[model samples]
Target: MAAAKIKKGDSVVVRSGKDKGRTGTVLQVMPKEGKVVVSGVNIAARHRKPTQVNPQGGIDRREAPLAISKIGLAVDGKPSRVRFETKDGKKVRVAVKSGETIDG
Candidate 1:
């Protein structure tokens, strides 16, 4: 599998989906599956059975994983393209707009 340009904690914008143009921080990355879970995006409700952790389990709202290709990195509060480069000895992915490395 190709290395994902986006990683956990990186801010991203939904590119093409029902949640298009929405921006959120990446909560998790499933590199093997080529998907990512973004905060407050692609939310889904699940009927949960009452458990010890949640005695009043009812509707559980959670972020659903979206395909990585559906998201674009957010730079300067706007969706921007990214490119990978090696600055010094470290390989870094930099935002095309500001040329700043996206924090992992």
Candidate 2:
């Protein structure tokens, strides 16, 4: 699997697609599939079958995964590039703008 720069809870901005320019937190990451689910982004409706527990069948709103390449990390509310760096013998990722390493 390829290494992923963004992780869960990281803030990101949609670089392209219908949600372009929208910013949201990263809810999940799928490195193998090169997809990431951002909170409040790529929402889709799902039809549910009524079960004994629910009696009423309804549509539910859910988040859908989008290609990782379509999103960009947001640093200090600004879209910036990211790079991996080594500090004190440990590899860490940092935002290019502030040069602050993002803790894992």
What TM-scores do the predictions have? 0.84, 0.87
Clash statistics: count for each candidate: 0, 0
Worst window of 10 by summed lDDT in candidate 2 = 75-84
Q: List candidate 2 stretches off by more than 4 Å.
A: none
Local accuracy of candidate 1 as per-residue lDDT tens digits, 1-104: 88678878888998898999999999999999999999999999999999999999899899999999899899877888788898787888989989888753
> Pairs clashing in candidate 2?
none
**Local accuracy of candidate 2 as per-residue lDDT tens digits, 1-104:** 65788889999999889988899999999999999999999999999999998789899999999999998899777777688988888888888878877774
- Scored by lDDT, model 2 comes in at 0.89
For residue 3, model 1's alpha carbon misses the true position, in angstroms, by 1.4
On the 0 to 100 scale, the lDDT of residue 54 in model 2 is: 79
- Count residue pairs with overlapping backbones in model 1: 0
Which candidate leads in TM-score?
2
